[model samples]
Target: MPALTKILIANRGEIACRIQRTAQALGYRTVAVFSDADADALHVQMADQSVRIGPAAVQQSYLNIPAIIEAARRTGVDAIHPGYGFLSENADFARACQDAGITFIGPSADAIELMGSKRLSKLAMIDAGVPCIQGYQGAEQDDATLSREAQRIGYPLMIKASAGGGGRGMRLVHEPGDLLEQIRTARSEALNGFGSDELILEQALIEPRHVEVQLFGDQHGNLIYLGERDCSIQRRHQKVVEEAPCPVMTESLRQAMGEAALKAGRAVNYVGVGTVEFLLDARGQFYFLEMNTRLQVEHPVTELITGLDLVAWQLNIAEGQVLPLRQDQVQLNGHAMEVRLYAEDPTQVFLPQTGRIDTWQPALGVRIDHGLLEGTTVSPFYDPMLGKLIAHGATREEARRKLLRAVQDTVLLGVRSNQRLLAGLLQHPSFISGQFSTAFISQHFAEHPCLHPHVPCAEELAIAAALFYQARAQAYRQPLAGWRNNASVPLHFNLGLDEQQWSVALDAVPGGAYRIQVADRSLALQVIDCDGRWATLEIDGVRQRHAYHLHAGQLSLFTRPGSLVIEDRTQALVSGQASVSCGTLKAPMDGAIVDVLVTQGSKVSKGQLLVVLEAMKMEHPLKAGIDGVLKRLQVRVGDQVKNRQVLLEVE
Candidate 1:
């Protein structure tokens, strides 16, 4: 495009801010597009200008091509950069950009179309002599064809959406009995998430390492691989942890994978930045996965090691600039690792969480890429990923340790997250030794203590109680706090946490200390100093500092294990209302009811799927908690419901 001077980021969240950082540094005025839900998002604030695209829904906002093109036109931008996800890989969106006379800082539409579909991409890779898993990628996608293919492919096959990525529309079936139902579920997820219901079957590669090669190409046919990243640490097919220069990679294997990736790129005449993923087995054999036609979320690790700005390269290539470095000139440096910080509750099957961010204090030693503020609300309208924390060191162990410390030190309260899980993973012996695969989490940590719901220990409870008492005393200016007519008398308090209640008694002692009793445990606690948000406490002769945020009668405290939210209900009146019964199924979070499998009054066995709720772009099957009749059905397909809203009741 005529020496592009202005660019519009056709995306949101951290990726948009990431693009803006590079584009603005390169002297290009940037434009940001936002939906109504993201009006106050950090990305919009960072851009030189912004335009409202549509509503909160992805179909009406980020995925709306015409609106984005119109945004570019109105901003008078010369180029548009589609960050990963949303319309990044949509061929029609690329074509729309080209037709609008705007430079699309990515590969051609034809290339995207070819690589976007798992079936077409696998077929193309096989033709290009790249090793591929034997699967059914035929054009015929009927139930019979899929069933026959499943039998031929044998048991333990994967049913994947042809146009899916990030784990959506994918399921692993272990036997013939579950094939049809899985196919139906996968198809539904695919159609909802990708606008396509095409299905593909692949032989499951048990415990394979999911590695990918980053490829950068120019208009002059100069393409080079920026090393590879090991993304085997995944959950539900979505990558959680990624590190550069695959942990088990040798020079020969790296070269082989890099060459295969280049071949795949060349077959489609690829340009700009892209990634070719592969499944590397234990026997040193690798098979082609799919190619992502945009910058990846894990690109920061590659950048940290190579000392290169991939976004700048994309902009330069789009402006007809030649590759900055040839394949021979590229160099890979030290080790780097990254962990995605997701707004999810790991103890609750990693259910996505949404709430206002009361505190967001990122660690200093690591590089944090996020779009968060103190008051930012983590809505359920988008992905649960809050941001990423990346660390670089001269050795793999150093990187791992640094990342682990960063994850522990970084404070993010208010909403539930997987911070503790990340810390545990980093400290695991298998992960520390780089002896893990995609099944690592399920195999090693399935029953790990960190995954279980956290109950406040004596120390944690004492800290919470002391902090709460101090805050309340200071707020009320109670000079006679903990004072009683009899010096031996103790102050009584009640606290609630995780739907459980505890009665605590605190006795004032000399030297500003207190003896706190929680259940059968007693703690000698003393609040050394407090500045409202952070407090240093000494419990049982051990001194420690914690970050805390108290709001709306709830105190969110960051302990050594993770974040704990406690409420002081000492003065509140007890309600006689009964709690929700086990037979009542409530919406776990805000979501739309996608399927109602059981009608009212229908008999259902325990563990039967009753409803499927689509939230955070994934389908969560709500199963029967007990065997009973469906006495009441309060929701149906297409009905939007809020968190804790009762969906049905089985009596």
Candidate 2:
């Protein structure tokens, strides 16, 4: 061991907490670096020592190398573990850490620099005799050159950022007409997400399986592959779900891919935990995808089957220790799967949502790596990935079933999430049979019924919400303020959910009962039991129970379908407009306007990109709904907008 004593985790959220867990378990003192937004975060509380680096924005905080180095120096930390994302793959950060006499808990700066660029990595892999996809990875990055290369590489091609992972700076161009625009968008995203705008074009594999091999090496020139993971299921070019021991992989194929990954690692004298991703086709052929120089988000699955702690290995390897397990001894057992839980609305094209989580409850019988707590404010300064939910089983089906149940049991109120979407994916038939590809989601759930079905049981939800509200009111109100003796009068409520409206009248009956009438339907309800946050009720003679939380005039009901947020507009009905005209386009969520694509009086067609709003580090384009001339643009570039705030009017 290289005299390692103290270590600093230079990241935030669950990742920082994850590294801290391993370090603390191994009898090492851990330090946490946080931004202004994460000052009171879970990771900060879990660390032995905490340091505030900078502001909320990532560029000024997590990616601020100088600030992180200074914090490490002040804290007297012996080493720094980047813990994926931020500056994990940054060679300059590693070099700076080395110069500061602080050990960086990863590969050398030269290895990071070599693998950080896709073009350079592809060249290295090709030189090492690894199978690479046929494409243009040249230095000429002009529009004309890229367009010619796109045509030469054929219609369906992928434009990928040379620097960074996580599908941030990636796009697929299907035809010639969309190539230029996609190139521009990809370049813009690349420049913003990574510090580099250089791109590489490759032949798009048609729905191939994304398999990756885990690699571990030590300073003694020893390396071993820890089997493989199938990460084919994706959305927006990023992995959504992952599993180990890819179903179709035979022993021969696994050995082949494993050896190829080992070759790639040996090419750079790699040391530490890394992953070499490959795009495997239906014909059992695999092409080299870029290598990740840091620990992966889905490393838990590999650990579960191998029965080894990858983080501990990384720490020991960083300390110049020999490989703990040899290639012949390392073995895989059983199966493992992991699902990413993101704070995004899959129905809204995976738009990132940010708000205070009034109620947060993780699932049971699963391993959850999260940094969430009740009342935690999920800000828009970083990634929308809340955490990961992992499950292990003797077979894939058992693991899938366990994960599915766990997803259903998870309770998160306030912000919209992909919880329902994840459940849908796990239960999908294609996913169950192990025949899924990268296009699984788009093919099956392009327009699923669960997305937003006709206002989401508006009448039942309205009645439940009103009753819940009345229960809270009774806790502090006059005994008969909302009750009637003769059952002649009922308490009335008008609510709005998105654009849908409801009018509910609830009559108080004996035994704390109620008769509810919403629109043309009438039903009976009884508050059998209530404990502030939960209510067991009899609706139309059918018994049902629900958990609820109310905040800021909004009631969130955790129902079978998921958390249904309803705005109690009973008071607003008397003063607010009955309905606003649909001429203006409003912001769907809180975000900053990055680009105003259309100006006043500009004639725009339906589905034309009119504005671009960025939230949680992802760009979302707000398009025009109807063909009309832009009459007024309310917001300019860089303006922070609230949910439902009108951005522009088309009339």
Candidate 3:
């Protein structure tokens, strides 16, 4: 254990940048490992030095242990910090670093291996009096065996991966008939995501609040719990929003959870920063989930609440320094919340999206940790998380309010994202009151998705749309052809950006108003004010200001950048077929073909899996729409595909 001079970060994205800032603050030189896609990434430029790990695909780059180790070796780094994902919990990587006489900057290989398996960790917890919800974690994992265990647990249960940590390796079963399939899906996802199908069972902890306590340990046998974080605001088990000092927690419950977390950490002799997750029910009872041996994605919430630099602690602990503070000295400050700004389409069930953040600015008084800043590309090969927008306030309500404002002001225009939805969720009554659960997204949700409650043709979006097309048409005419010394010609254009398909259309008219076609009722739009990129107008004769942006050569009227793509009709492709043909399979959008699940001529059933596409660090399973023999596999593993390009054919 010594004062480290150089530390190499073994991951990319904002987390790597976050780790670097802390390490640099402590006077340590930092090196960054980046893939080709991240060559121009902010982290690469921020680090003292950077090395090319491999290609953009995570498997060959960030997740490749040898490449990361080599990056460390080449940089002459004293320690390698696996900043969360790629190999954060990898025991072999830890051992290799140890063998090479370099510190892993995380827990020992034994600690990682012990907690790597849920069954083993649960056993250790149970022995140490850590109460876990009743579920099976034995060796028997067949379909029937898992079914019996699920039934024994209850009608509502959860299937968890033994080695899974993220929301990836888990499934929820609400009915007995759906248990096996859920288990299979969970196991399959676990295998695909973590390279392990080994799973366990647990009580789903119905409608319980998701809470986790942060634990810090050092080699000197000292451990402290840094209170808790309420990551209940989640989608697809992935956290969309998180906050500190859960409003739902009673003082008594907090102490109890904190003590339980310490016991779990001490039992495994955990080192560095880790989080012990728990499911807190309405009645305030809590149950053990698992321990994350690395920094959590939502660690910013903890840092804000405790006002401590966790990355510095990781470095110090790895260098064999005893913790400077004791558990009794820990204090929780004002409320803080973190919203994950992802390149995703919130209007389309939170799908991962990739594009540029053309206008990147968070509201004032908010701490923005952006990975893909303005002019940065949101690549399809990595996690869609562009940055974390965190806000701290005197109270949770104030924090939530500030976070909503931050989201509203962000203006991410390149690809779709849940910016508007995030704003809506932050202001949601249930969310504000802190009444949330895992089923929050799919349950009691809106049947219709609209950026704003009302879409006025005479609004700012309408004006921007008309102006953009008018500008394009003007450019086509002449540099001074449309130069109106007489009068400004009333521009006319049509817009067909019907997001839900059941919605209406618009035929643009002069002076920036439009004739609307929603259902059988056609309305008139009157333009009131035009502000270049924004407009103010009347829908049915009511005026309201709205957000608008010009991106991808089209005028998008305040739409989520993640899901919906607004195409200028003048540039849209016209297909001869009324419907896409039977045999052809096209990609939903532009993304890398991460995995070719089915080969050419592979027989498949309707909805059977074909390829696993990874875009924006999220995995998408492309299923067969019709029962047929596959033909003309257009993509190979690691090939990048685009929107509407035929990925395969079923004859």
Candidate 4:
């Protein structure tokens, strides 16, 4: 076997750290590659050696092929592991590694090329006898053709990018009226993301279970199964909560799926590790979804139950190790569940949140994979996934409970997370009963939404704290603006949180502590630190922590990052279950904003164009969200926004 003394992790964040742990345990050193924004990142500091890839933008750095290969050569690393996403499945990158005499810790270039494109993979699966959803893969970017296919496959069809991956490049057409536009949009996104606008049409499965099997193969031709994970709990076609030994699976079904996975693997002459995703309907019928050729973010669930370190096996296999084990040798034990802690706003359509973490840590339970430290800053240029929290237990229920308990411990003081939504799902009766489907999160949670514990009452706990900080700030004044003199500035302040707003009146109480009244409650508090970003205070015998940040001049309390609790002090301004963001022009899908039509102080009438955003290298006009004078343009040309964020606010 080729000895892998040093492995260069061509990725960042939790996955890099995760690889380091396994490589270290196996007596191998790790090399981490990072972007400019990651200079202080946890993964960079943890690696044995590090290399700076590029500026903060992924195009100039992490996704840059030449940069990755050069780093490997400079570091004298033997192999490169494209953890997941980014360049993980790029066929050209794989071939580049091979040409450079560097082992790519993944499948052969041909496998990625064939399977990377949904059209070819589906053709291969059809020939190999794997069941598939009804749809057409061969076609040009013609709307008429898509409309006809949508009619044949029937309504409720899914438009997917043949060359697209991630949750991007795909959309569902529930009715005939929206089929053509959705297809056009999906194709554009697919082109923008994967550089190929190839589009495919498939029948959308109702009540589908996003189950996938973990498959491994050696150059010697031995293949094995690591059971399956029920990742049915998903948002935007991406998994949120995953559990092992699916609560409704049987041994017979396991054998059938395992064999099918091997067939697909062998078809591509697969190497290293890969995941074959499938969509299983409520009727127990299953169809091929796609093959993820690189290590998956959710690999931990498979490892937890199968008692194997997948990353280790990838390194061994890439180094030309022979098949030391067979399918029968693999075993599934216990139960496992994983929750993704993202720096996102769940209550507001999962908008990517960027800011420094004022307070919080992902809870530990059996295992958790994260890449940020206490003071880490989440950047908008990368994926918002901060870390993953996983738990192992004897039963699924036990694991579910453990995962919930772990989420409650996140004290993320800055930014917002979807933790509360995750907790609600964990506690929901359907979730506990294993009755959840891909539609569960959007259909149920989005409507009712999960509510976290009411903010600590304005009693002696929080109010006294805010007051103390205000007092402390006034006291530490360089000129000492004594309380009496600073009275004109309004010592009374209002802090807005999500769901509830606080109006606080500050009063000095002797010593360093101060007294304040909140919503009819009064108390004394000793403030620890007070800044424009956060307010930390010791209250009511327990240390209570809270964060305050400005969003469009409106204050929001970012209390929990691990949980998706974003308390908006502007809650009163926001009524109904919906959020009232400044009028925004959303990118129909993932695209680059180019040629902002209006600058600061430009006014346009209704239906007037304001910006030109480009996707798939094609220009798209961003119309005004409202008929008002445009002011404060936040994004410039070439800026990237995910899903929704105000592009140009009109007043």
Candidate 5:
């Protein structure tokens, strides 16, 4: 292949920017392709040139092969890099790049085709003497065959999409009764997400550690492993935290796993970067899962420990260069950990969030890979992961502490996120001791305080009240700060948050201090300084600073518990209107309606499945909140709906 001078990144968001950074550093001009929604995205601005591929939808944009190739052709680029996600693991995409005379900076299309399917990859691994779980990977994909096979495999088996990864198109069936339903759902999801509904079954390993070995190979028949990462910290089968050098890995175990991973790579003549995932049980036995045929989202941890840039290595390998280092020469340095910062609401079952980012303050002394500006709008057209926070240290404890502080200090306001949950998990005893598995979140975080809805405390309310008062005083340019016509009377204000209201009274004291009362608690507050966003306050004699953003009567404050949004409703009119009936069902977020389980005039129970909305590449089933007859249905199976739009009405 000719030297790669100008490369076109056929993706968007952080990964695109990440690849561009590395490519530009290596004297390679980079081109970016984006959808209509991402025309003003950070990645587009960072690239040397950009092309509009298609509209906001993935099928018409990022996943549109012809459009991506045409963009590359139009830009006169020499190579095309499909950064993870959209078409990263797509074999046809790789082949198209190869056919278009554009070097595909990845493994061979044959390798991608072989390993993209869980079923096919497992069969090859078994034939190559690699350890694999006992299950069914047959060609008969009929529901009856899958059900019978499930019976033979016993209860507690995993239904996995052959052409899927990233936790999609997968389900765990704990009983025989739910096998068929899970298989159907998994197949449907797999079909929609991967264009193939083929599935495989395997015995679910209980309390197993999710470990993966990073492998790199070249066309010169050389392959090596760059250690392993423990991705056991996950939720809904998606990884939340990843770290390099498995915590419990012994020298022998590492060697065994690495050799097995190399063997899997060699089976398909893999080149460039790939990962072999496995399930490491408590007994030191590991079984092959599937192989990811591109740079992983968790690759930063490996790069930090190995002291090598994987993307640069990928570029060199794509240029037909030999492996940068041999298996024995590979050295694993200190410790490194990374956490995925997602745009989600922990209190609302981790639902993906979308809105304009009002404030973007990344933590110092860490590596943050994200494509976000202060005013960037996070749309619902893609994944919810905003970026990653990575920390490297001489020890695991150091890395953990640094990551915990980063999670707390990095402020992202104007939208809900899982910041508190990430902080809690980082400091939790189980995580601190490195004693965790893939079941960590599901087993322990269900009722954890960090995941619960936060009700603002008296101190927080007082701080918000003070900020609100200061904003009003500034708005009116009060001649005398906190001055009142009636000196003996106090100022009353009402604040609202999360549908709850609080009435607070503030009494202006001498020397620019105020005594605030919320419910039964009273505190003395002195605003040392206020700049509209950051404020220094002496509350009850405790001097500290806090971050806040006030816009249109809504004050977003960063407190000890988490980010809170308090609305100043003191001047709002009091309405006697009744609340909307519980029978009304609305779309939780912007998404396409994929399934309508009930028709108009159908009798539905309180918990009956009403609709399945597909958003952020996941399916969410909307259930009826009250028992009633379905009086109206306003959406069909392929209708795109907006957030809070009424989907149905039950009378």
Candidate 6:
């Protein structure tokens, strides 16, 4: 077969750019398909050729099989690389590519179909002599049979969507009473996420480590496992951090798990890159979870350890080539850890944050796979993940330390992210000592929160933000008002941060210096250096250089703790209307109202669920923060709302 000369990436954001980079290096022309929302995306700009797929909605664009296949045909590409998510594991898309005489850079349609469904995959594993958790995979879809199966499986069971992964259609029920409701939710989410409502029941393993083996196969029927990744660090069933060479993995355990992974591949005559996930319990017994039939999101850690380009291998395999490396030929190297930087607020229950990234500065001495630019607008239509940071070192401790520094040095302004949270996790004693389970975040961080909270730099940021704004204002004025020979007056400003407001005063000192006072905390600051988007200041005799960005009346000050955004309320304060507070609850972000749990005029207690907002493919339920009567319900199910739009009023 001829080699894949031109390829079309039927995905967007970082994955698209990632595929383009590898394809270009291998002497292949690349084409990128993008939605309306991603017209100015980084991936689109990096590709050799581009095509407009459809609207911002995923169904009309990335997941639109017909459109993607047509784009490949139009570009005259030989193969289509569905870079994970979207249509990557969709058997129909792969089959479509094959029917169109275009290569799909992944496993065969038969392999994907067999492994895509958890129910069928479990049965397949059982037939192949793979140890699987005791659960129900029968075809009975009735609630009575499922409930009976749940009873037989006992309490503390898991309900999962048969059609997909990514924690979308999965839920845990610890009690018999909650099983039915959870099953309903899981089915709804499953059908919406994967177009299938088929459910599967599994015995929930208590605190088992989530380990997966990365394997590759070719048409020659040779399969080899590169290594394993410890994906035990998760939150809300989504993996936040992953590492290669699991801390608890011994030589024997590795060999056993690796063999099982190879057995899984051989069972399906698997080809191309795939991941076989397993749950390793405290006693070292591993049980099959499922198989992912495409390149995984955490593939970088494996790549770093094996020093092999999995994407290059995928291309070669698609060209009907033999396996590049044998089992013995693969050598494990040093340690590597990856942290996903999401556009979210860890403090706010991980609610997705969206806005333009005014300042984008990634740290040095690490590998950053991202699609962010200075003016990148993070829309609510896509995933909240901004990028990923991978750090490699000779030792696990060294890798952890380097990753913590990398997270600290990184500066992403204008949107809230989990940078500080990731830093905190790396410094936690449990993480540092390598003694953690899948429940690490829940047991230590989620309920308790902030294992090592960054010291509060709010006061410093407030003062610096004021000074930066004042400097910008004066720089564009005649004679530079603040630089006058006899500067005697002070500039008064009001800044708002969430519920707290700061009354700040800045007095221009002699020689272009300033004395800033924010609610009695005075700081003697000098502008050591500054540019359009950054500033270096000497505050109270301590020198610190930082990046700052001002856009749409909001100022972002990049500090060691993280980016601090302060809203300029000076005008509102002067107008005497800023101090007013309303009892209306607004939509936290732009999303579709999925469910209205309460009716108008219904009384609600504190923490009572009110409405569910779906954005970035996740559901966030809005609850009442105060006990009151829900006097008005402003939204209904399926209603699309904008950020800060009033969803309800409580009184």
Error of 3 at 360 (Å): 2.4
Local distance difference test, each candidate: 0.90, 0.85, 0.77, 0.77, 0.90, 0.85
Q: What value of lDDT does candidate 2 attain over all alpha carbons?
A: 0.85
Q: What TM-score does candidate 4 get on C-alpha atoms?
A: 0.80
| Error of model 2, residue 451, in angstroms | 3.4
**For residues 366-400, what per-residue lDDT tens digits would candidate 3 score against the true structure?**
88876666677788898777788999998998998
In the range 443-562, model 1's lDDT, one tens digit per residue, is 989888778878888888788888777876666445666455786877887988865788998887766699999899988998898897899888888888999998767899997546
How large an RMSD does model 2 have? 7.5
Q: Which stretches of candidate 6 lie over 4 Å from their true place?
A: 447-459, 465-469, 472-480, 483-489, 574-651
Which digits, one per residue and each the tens of the lDDT, describe model 5 over residues 1-651?
667799999888889999999999999999999899999999999999999999999999999999999999999999988989889988999999989998999999999999988899899999998999989999999989999999999879999999887778899999999988898899899999788999999998998999999999998999999999999999878999999888998999999999999899989998999999999999999999989999999999999999999999988988888887888899999899999999998887787889888888888998999999888899999999999999999999999999888999998888788889999999889999999999998888889987777888998999988888887776765476556789788888899886579999998766668899999999999999899878999999999988889999999998743589899999987642212235678787899999988899999987678889999998888887678899999999999999889899997
The parts of candidate 1 lying over 4 Å away from their true place are 478-487, 509-511, 580-651
User: lDDT per residue, candidate 4, 1-651, as tens digits?
Assistant: 578898899999999889888988999888999999999988889889999989999999999999989999999988888899899998899999999999888999999999988998999999998888899988565888777777889978888889876678899889898876777788778878878888889998987888999888999888887899899998888788988988889898888888889889988888888899999888888899999898889999888998888998888888888766777777788999998888777656677888877555556655888887867789889999988889999899898888888887755655677777778788899999998788987778756544333454564235433533454456566566344665534256555444344677666544546566676766666667766555667665566665554333343454443422232232235322122234555555577877866777777776677777677777767666356776567888888976555666666
Q: Candidate 6: lDDT of 176?
A: 93
Q: TM-score winner among the candidates?
A: 5
On the 0 to 100 scale, the lDDT of residue 620 in model 2 is: 82
Instruction: Compose the digit string of candidate 2's lDDT tens values, residues 391-497.
Output: 99999998999888888778888888888888889988889999988898889888875464336564456456555556555756577455455558677777777
Q: How good is model 2 by TM-score?
A: 0.86
Score residue 359 of candidate 1 by CA lDDT. 87
Scored by lDDT, model 4 comes in at: 0.77
Which 10-residue window of candidate 5 scores lowest in summed lDDT?
574-583
RMSD, every candidate, angstroms: 7.6, 7.5, 8.6, 8.6, 7.6, 7.5
In candidate 2, the residue pairs with backbone N, CA or C atoms under 3 Å apart (3 or more residues apart, or in different chains) clash, namely none
Q: Each prediction's TM-score against the native?
A: 0.88, 0.86, 0.80, 0.80, 0.89, 0.88
Residue-level lDDT of model 6, residues 134-180, one tens digit each, is 99999998899999999999879999999968888899999999988
